[model samples]
Target: MHRSRKADAPRADRVGRAGSGALALLAIAATLAGCQRGSSETPTVPTTGPGGCPAVRAAAQAAVAQAERTDTAWDGPTTGPAAVSGRTVVFVAETMTNPGVAGVANGLREAARVVGWDLRVIDGAGSPAGIQAAMSEAVTLRPSGIVIGGFDPGSTAQQVADAAAAGIPLVGWHAVVAPGPSSRPPLFTNVTTRVEDVAGISAQWIIAHSGGRAGVVVFTDASVPFARTKSDLITAKLATCAGVRLLAYENIPIPDASSRTPREIASLLARFPDTWTHSVAINDLYFADAAPAFRAAGRKGTGPPFNIGAGDGDPSAFQRINSGQYQAATVPEPLTQQGWQIVDEFNRAFSHRPASGYVAPTHVSTAANSAGATTWDPPGYREAYRRIWGR
Candidate 1:
């Protein structure tokens, strides 16, 4: 197990896709199973976008409906495996070095114990090769199921097939698409937020805040396919803004993100100067140094060029948002909540029950809510998963 980062201490710890249509509704219906849907009462959503982007405002308003699902309660398979008391569940973490990964593993460890399941977590070191090796080792154990955090589908196709062939149910957290119950994907299911939508949340905010005329400099991490998708969506959404301009769209693969982010921003600052209004990246980790770099370039303007990111919920990110400086909002996934949910997903698949994989309850933390929120876990969520298992 990797050492967990202290949320109150310092910063750093790095760490999605699409397909949310009819299958999405079915998945939501499955998770919310018996809960009643449909309500004309709409919740008031905050708008960080300027007054020009009605579309952005509408997107924010639409998020209110998801809140009705209320992911705090455990709504997984009620009759799963009678008791997963002796089942050895393998949790394949992308890397414990990252806070989000460590936090998720911690949640699963706690949840597994609560559910009386034997959990063996073979964590990675934040690399593609590391994930592949973990998957390879997991296959030999032939555990009841496997939960992959931050998985890349295209790369892990073979490993997933082998696990499925050997009768090991696989569930991914925030790395692949939910291929639906009928699609029969290599992985049984995926529990995640639509990363593209999460990133778009920030874009929507930017366009509104920018008065619908925004120039965005997008720095995409190409190392992960999910990150690529997020950046692609941000670019595409920004294009829809009435007076949008894409100043620059660069692929800063993880290998180069840390080393190149500041320079990339600095270069964009020099070249486009006033053309760029918002800066969106796959995650805030890439901007560990870029925030100061942005300030260093003396972008002392009014409120136009805001910095926003997804894969939100890191301590430093919240701090940046709270500071009301360069950061505007960071869209965060409820990682700890999803941690327990992943185990439940495996349980459902293991028992041959219809596994409607969950989409982690995600929300964007802006300056308005930074005081009330943190980046590690969802607010007001407790470990009540024991109830889901009828304990």
Candidate 2:
């Protein structure tokens, strides 16, 4: 969750694959159970690649289309001269402690290179005032745009509004709390992981593996506003599928899992003790710590109870999934990818061609599918990144 160092930018030789085709399809499918009805004016779809994956191409094209549709904060002098150059786009996060956020930052720097925008990321130290200071500095520096993915977007509306007042488009990702469901300022475009989509996919996976009925153990934080929102969503969606019951849900603030960890996990194991099961953890970080606890207590196997399902595509959880520890987990593409998309969309919006709507891609890695994968960093993105940044 820490800001990436300037020297750590992707190197010219460390290129990763650009699987927008697979990624796009994954994103679309993740976001929609079914495709949206095509408007009479719906644009043509892009052709597929050698993998015979059409969805990825379609998503890439859709991303481009999305870029075309959204408007930017700039109103005067559309193209007489570039609005800004060698400008920086700062990303302010809750705390720079998560690896997934780092991955996103890498992908974003690459994307910024494509659009000719430089990047400067900051950590919010998980505080409202810290985020405000970051935002204040960003405004003073006047970068082309700013990306804020605070732990609780609700806590920083005033600072965000202030950035808006300075004509900086504040781009927010996952877990955005809208000014209201229907109200959003032109200076902002909220982007998130599409929680319902992620939940639905995770649900589908659980239903398939668990035979439509499973007991769940939800690790949540009732005190944290964002976790509460997601915990509620996961709880309600579990009911959508038949036979799935929340056997027990523990809302222990993370790391504090020490006291409640053994007690609650042991309690759930005692109650449902079968290996054919589907459990849900808030994310990989928590899963990394707790999944093993479940396993140590003899909770891994196939039958009435099985391993828990973790979210957020966090890398550590992916490592566990690779080792045949967890059944499956979802990982967002390198945060660099999301950042790149933001830069692209920002430029488009600034140039008066904002995206209509877009979905960032995700990878659902299971033991069988993710084999031979050494790391999450793709192959071609690095080259693209180096080309953009001249690094």
Candidate 3:
């Protein structure tokens, strides 16, 4: 679900099964706006009970309500070419190699093809200036619509507002506009997992597995909102688990693409001699170093060694989980689903019976199913999507 208010700010691991086309249909009905509740309030989900779908429905409603309240934009007047179907759709992102994000780009392309619309892609390499330049270039083409992944809204609010001003719908794919009180114009449409939701889920998992007894040493790439949000959420949630203690939640200052694993691992081993049962990670990207170090130091498994981790389902994370090198991980459906969902909404926005909003929640994948898993699969609505775009 989606919402309309904005606020303050912050901060994945794992894998799960591929979804079917019916997912899109289910989302449309389950995620109508106005159902989401406040961030702090977690609805009573059936922790242990039968017919849990009702509880799940309540939770889903709360999630949708939260999204609507948080990312509400001005609902600007419809813009763009009178005929949206033939207009080109362009997707812009921070980079293509980011596993979660790449899935989104692929989804948008596939959706575009399904709808018979033209598609173009641009990579910004995580550079603010590069992304700005890319957005500027994208606007010049006057495409029917645009989708963005992982660009900070505070920095690009004006550019996005300008796109909307031009009458082109600006849709946020995987990343929602930042959502603190200070966040800029909320994204028009987004497929996001609220930071708290991700953190709460992780904390619940950790606490359950560790019997509320665990120690933590966190590594965060402060640049990503989702990462920062997750970190903040974990810090708060862990405080409640009396048995769980956070040893350190500091940022690791590693240059982009730098190999800081050995140094980080060495520091962790040296600094936290007692060993933690779990080391929380924000994404698979950071595991390049953290995972190996945990294994090398003999910190993994059912007991003794701390469980190593790779946050999101980066391919390596899947491998690490399957091999028992890491304990567990969270894998959302590829960002492609986000892309496809946003496009589906965009298409509806063109029609009079457009949907008010929607949410695409993620699934968690563990070691048992992580072996040989692939994150990039076409949406289940491939045929329907293709029917709209064409073969």
Candidate 4:
């Protein structure tokens, strides 16, 4: 059985946070515009810094080389509780429209079928009130377990507390900052690749692709702590390569990305037309939203401003990469695999076993290696989980 509802209007407070981030970016653009008025020459990217970029670029290339490998054996847990039969679970999603959240939901749905568990999904529609309401309803259902499917558990503290009081085991898919059991929010386990690994490789991709000299813009949703942290790490990593100039840090919220991205892209183009050589965003969807504006600006699909998403490689992102659209590469989470892990974690909780401390290794996908596939579904995980569950 499945149930879902549309979220109401966003909470005023979250909207304000999103707005402040956007306003800061606009102010940055305005200031840059004033500074560049007399200069017709493109700013030169510094190639020879204190140590020069050759060593850094070489190291980055090697790290990227390892991450791009598609043949990695499954490193997740090989032992776990066998399937607990006839259980019921609820998945409270941030929004079905978010590819990462939806992709994980699809995976969980598949895993639940394999495990013979009843499953329900409630869409939070990308708003605080909606997410809170969805969490409240999820707790009210008294399901055997609840999956916090991509929103911060802290935001729904009262409902989370209620579920905890009821002794419902909770699992999370990117619900917290870390990947293992979270004591603070009482999640059995949180499934995700390490954000530092994801962020580092993404910046390294740009460094390797550009041969160490490029001007870059980073896009992030400040409204989500996970996203903001990833983008901040990306910024810090990019700083290591002195040749890579940080042009702008655009803070467009994920929910408002489609409506605001085109306009922001236009502003970025006008502000740093010649120097902006690359982009990295916290999510792949930003590139999807920026495509039209790039087209209008006469930027080629094969771009000087090569784009890479730091996380969540959805079908659309793969299509863009394979077709040489706006995106060049992505550091994608293994969404389906993580979904299967979520079910596995819940099973462990149900069996009174300890949470599996497995974290998926970060991966980077590019046009050269993607081979036209959609999601970054790693091999052996499905078989491994099935083996563990004795299915």
For model 1, how does the per-residue alpha-carbon lDDT over 1-391 read when each residue is reduced to its tens digit?
1111111211111111244432343333223222121111111221123445566545544653343233345443334443356788888877765656666777778777777888888876666677778888988898988877765544567887898788777776654543233233456777767655575566676665665767766665544545645565565566554466666566665555567777776777777777667777777766565776777887652234687766746667777777766777677666677777777776667667767544555566776654545554653334344555665
Clash count for each candidate, listed in order shown? 6, 41, 48, 0
lDDT of all predictions: 0.60, 0.50, 0.52, 0.81
Ranking by lDDT: 4, 1, 3, 2
TM-score of each: 0.76, 0.67, 0.70, 0.88
TM-score, cand. 3 vs. native: 0.70
lDDT of 4 by residue, 218-295 (tens): 887765666755665676677677677878778676767789899999989999999999999998999999999999
Pick by lDDT: which candidate is best? 4
Q: Candidate 2, residues 1-391: lDDT per residue as tens digits?
A: 1221111222211111112232344344323222222110111221111332233334333433332221223221112212335667888765666565656666676666665667888876555577667666766787777776544444566766777778777776553422111134333455545544444445445545554556666566555544444444555545444455555556665535555555666666666676325666555555555655667786552323444443455566667667766435443333554555466556555766544255533345555555535234333443443343344
- Residue 306 of model 2: what lDDT? 43
RMSD versus native structure for model 4: 7.0
- Could you tell me the TM-score of candidate 1? 0.76
Where in model 1 is the C-alpha error above 4 Å?
Answer: 1-17, 20-83, 179-185, 299-304, 379-384
Candidate 4 segments whose C-alpha is farther than 4 A from its true place: 1-52
Top candidate when judged by TM-score against the true structure? 4
lDDT of 1 at 16: 13
- In model 4, pairs of residues that clash are none
